[model samples]
Target: MLQSSPKGSSSLSDNDNSSDLKSTMNDISSQTNENSDYSILPMDVIVDILSFLILSKQSINEYCNFLQSVHNKNHHSIFNLFFGYKHWDIHKTHVVFLYRNFIVKGDLTPYESRNPSEKVEQDGFIMNYIFKHAHTLTVDYCPMTDTYCQSLRKNKRIERFTFIGNRKHYHSGLCSALRECESLKKLKLDSVYDWEFTKLFELASLTYLKLNTGMMLRDFPPQKYNFDFIVDIEENQGSIKKILKNEFSESRLKHLSLISSEGFTDEYSVSNLMKLPALEILFLENQKITKQSMRTVGQSNLREICFERCLNFSDSGMEQLMKVKLPNLTKLKLSGCGFNTSNLKKVFEPSNGEILNQLTYIELSKNQNMKDTAFSKLGSFKFENLDTVDLNHCVSLSSIGILTFMRSFSECIRTLKLRECNLDETALVTILKSCSKLQRLDLEMNNISCTNIEICEITDLSNLHYLRIEKNNLTDIEWLIALPLSNLQLPRKISNYGTMQLDRQIP
Candidate 1:
């Protein structure tokens, strides 16, 4: 029996996360003294616990059992097998070479069905051992000419399956294997297949599926594949429409994400995807969808929607969005969606002369077109339950709009990020004066010159912990001396070039 230190620390400095397990084992050992007549834990329990550690540590049971064997002075060659490689190469090699579940081709000469004289016992045994117990199985272009997929398809308990092969080989294997896999809930295939979807519909328990059709990187016959390229707006729309029409009709689908090299989906594809009854979250990136597509989302029961790099969703989209009755929607993200200062008025103006109360988090960043009016409309939106607002990298935004927005959510907002925004001393002072209930504030790479002075004024934010103000022209070291915060992110290089200038004060 071994007793670990109260502050558990492992000898293997790199394996710090294992300290908790070692400490728990030591505690159990100390309680169950070796001298006492105590019943040992069941073998099944040991195996179950060992399974979790299996992914991280190589043969952890062997190491602990070897230590036990050595403690009784009965060290043998079997104990030498407990020695693990210091690096990951041998572990990976073991998985690649020995693990039959990965389906790596080895010396198949002995496994040939015609070879009656050749020994096939070991290969059969290993394959049987793997297919009998493997929960997660991957087959990547491994030739199974002799034994059909039916031999390994009876593993009904397999929860995950990954297929990577040419169209003909992989689709046939999938169609064959799907008949026996009643327990498979997830399936990932990197290659495209002819629509053999009846096999997909058979699995009653299937809830999640991720299919990547990124292999054939070309458009239709007329259009050649563009190089040094962002996502083609036309090509992306077609791809999205294909998925929405064929694949996304699953009633159990809760989360759906389509990530192209670019970020955008057109209105038609977007409208079709919104028809999913159970889809709660949807992500569309790098497609040239306009505000009209954003309006289609309002008809669904979606709670979270993310639009990344969708350049055409301008102020008009925001106007249409305000009129949509989204009672369940909570989180909305518009990253790199590109909105200018003029469009801010249309976005933040009262939609149909009413406020949107369901949206809890709003993140609009990297839109170089943002102006003071944009922040002003955001400030006046009057969202009662809003908690987080991210307005980062709008360098043209002035204090008036931001201050007005903060006034609307002076109490509810918990996290606020306004990095690289054109906020000087005047803007920072206004935010501190108005926003009293913030928990985290990020004002990094801004045009602010008086960091220390502005920080001292923000003492009303009691729950504030995470603060970042990096790479700005604020050099006063004493600015943060009096503030009481749990966490503070200082500027990497504080510049002392500009004077502490302000246009207006809080009267």
Candidate 2:
């Protein structure tokens, strides 16, 4: 196994990022033991992976598995099949591709089914190239032919599979072929025909499942789809929740995520998703659940809970959920949900807030309703184990309230994000003074000490190695020169004068 060095030393520009990723890929060829016999992959195979590596947009975690095939010589079968451009031309290429459960097509009109034969032929062509480097099969907008499923049964190398909106009949052969994939552990489904879900979930090897309907949900549509496994939000009360519980009750799932389309049912539901005995993480996206749906959140064994873009997930609902027995929770993220200061303050004001100290990462970004008063009130409490805090895009916040907010976790905080918060020099200075353990700081898109280049110095942030100061109001280059920086981002200024300044500084 190749060991990754500290990733804090890479440059921040896009061009530098490309070279850095290339260097990391080359490291794979050189890191293996010289005496060990291993298959040398052709250049095209390596380039297939490199095409997707955007160092500036991606993290070092993506490279951690580069050497997975080196130890097992048999895995060299991956190289036997050339991918992407092999035996194909530009006309067949339509969009970005990868091995994952999710991808957004650039535009549907271009790839819209021209004809059934052509579509299946294109899909089969795609499936052939997709698994040469990694085995994640995703069937979307294309029929699953016997050839591909038969290959899957024979190889049985696929560990994760995503089936979205594919209506092909799963005959006995197809089901048997899928069952042969004992390595499959994670499954994602957007749309499935009636009665097919029972056969799918019966796979004993599956430990993670997600049911989602994003982008096409009509307003106040029934929370329950016609399918037996459908799970939706409050409308006609607990009907959706009841169906969800009954459908998945017997499964041995460890992680579950429910994402409803961008609409909430006006009706209410009484039951909670926590009743699932084996669930460890619950992620809800774009669905509005009532307080009753989360009433027993404290009773679940969940260690992480995330709600993204779920409007009307009210502050009172959040307060009720936090007051329960969430002793095992280690991470919490609530973004794009409207939570105001008073209600936000109450979640961690004191006695009712002690369980929060156990969380290592917490993000309340995009909660535009939060103001200075929330953090000011929270300053009285201590978040002992919280290492990361994301207060990004909380425009209502200024330096005063944020300064007070930092007091609660400043001692233990390691990664802090204050992007788009419009902070000033005083608050930034206070952050440097207080957060001694900070390693990564993102203060992008802020007005922080933007105008004055003097009287503000961050040399005190001794442990800080990654800093994002892009889009600030700083006056000149001198302010950036004084720091013990490893990965530094230049302020956004695109004038001729800016170009000259860069030349002068470097030359």
Candidate 3:
């Protein structure tokens, strides 16, 4: 009878413990239900959160979580809207993610622990999956093995391909695969050698090409042809004529960009470059381009030209360039070319008065020697279609010169950058008053100090959305309080009054 009583007590205790466990689980489930109620959030709020996660750089785990969230919400439509259809397709975004994570960042720790052959196979599988639907691809610092190259050959729809090669590893298979991409239209190769241009030019569908030779030709093997091989020809005319006689003569190539490459110092190279009659855009950066080269470039049917750090290009080079009657030329950029005020006049006011009537954009940044005289002469020229101008770091120009220049181009100017220029309060006011159509203005690092009354002039710029006036001596705060600015950069030394004004006005 005593043993039976003990067993009954044990059963009672077990029952009580079971009841407590069930109660605790019920409380936890209730709390979870309360936390999982994301339905209260508006659709726009959820979309904003997702968009931020997609655009911002995040850890792989975070990205996976975002993808899972996106899947759960069935909000794949946000990707289409976030990355505009014209800029990116759904497949392009996926490829970008793969490239950014695995190639660019070199974050392959998860796969590195695997066996070598297994890792290669896994990488190939992942790459094939991502690139199966991609139309445009850019590869930088990522060496392509034979397996990957063979996979690339299968993508017949790829239109644009950019490869920035690694110096340590040369992948011949990749180049061989590229040669078979009959549908490719645009190709960009950087720091690559041993390429057969004859085969590249054979790509009848190719229209755009960019070649950047970061290392000198002497560093390459004797068998490898430098990108500047065209310029290396002693008889430039004959070489160019030969190319014209070759299959490339009828080639549809239109845009060409050569950067940090050698062999463009002489007239022959220049003449040879100009022989490409179908060329429409030419970009020369860090090249030894002389006056003769500029003349040849100007003779081309090019609609746009960019020259950056072309130290050999002097006033005479600019003069010769302006002399040509390039009716189709509309955009020009001369950054860090060391051209001065004197050269500026030659281009703007050539004796022939053959103005760049179609010109719409001009950039003359980092021309430290440019001063008031240059702008004064520029004002005399007729830039009827001029809309955008960047004169950043042209520190020689003072308030008077800038004021005069702005007043001249006021009617057509829409975007202006005067960063680090010697602009004072008067110049700033003058710009505000004259550039009625100005949409963006940058006056950072200028000597602009305005009184409360003087600052009122800013209100007149109704169309201005971006205004950068940092490092200025602006002491007034009241004028900025009521302005409907979409973007604003204030002076570093904001007074207490200014802080209070901003706090009160911002909300």
TM-score to native of every candidate shown = 0.61, 0.62, 0.66
Q: Give the residue spans of candidate 3 off by over 4 A.
A: 1-134, 153-155, 169-173, 193-199, 217-243, 261-271, 350-353, 378-380, 451-459, 479-507
Compared with the true structure, the alpha-carbon lDDT of candidate 3 equals 0.59
Error of 2 at 292 (Å): 2.3
Put down candidate 2 lDDT per residue, 40-139, tens digits, no spaces.
5445544544343323223323333333336423222222221212222222233333333223221122223657766655455545445322356555
Model 3 quality (TM-score) = 0.66
For model 1, state the Cα shift of residue 260 in Å. 1.2
Q: Write the per-residue lDDT of candidate 1 for residues 246-265, one digit (tens) a residue.
A: 33344565665554443223
Q: What C-alpha lDDT does candidate 1 achieve relative to the native structure?
A: 0.54
- Every candidate's lDDT: 0.54, 0.58, 0.59
Candidate achieving the largest TM-score: 3
Error of 2 at 55 (Å): 30
State the displacement of the C-alpha of residue 507, model 1, in Å, after optimal TM-score superposition. Answer: 34
Q: Who is ahead in TM-score, 2 or 3?
A: 3
- Which one wins on lDDT? 3
Model 1 error, position 143 (Å): 12
lDDT winner between 2 and 3, please give it: 3
lDDT of 1 at 292: 73
Predictions: Cα RMSD each: 11.4, 12.4, 13.4
Which regions of candidate 2 fall more than 4 Å away from where they truly are? 1-135, 139-158, 163-183, 189-202, 214-250, 263-272, 450-459, 483-507
Output the TM-score of candidate 1.
0.61
What is the full ranking by lDDT, best candidate first?
3, 2, 1
The Cα error of candidate 2 at residue 80, in Å, is 12
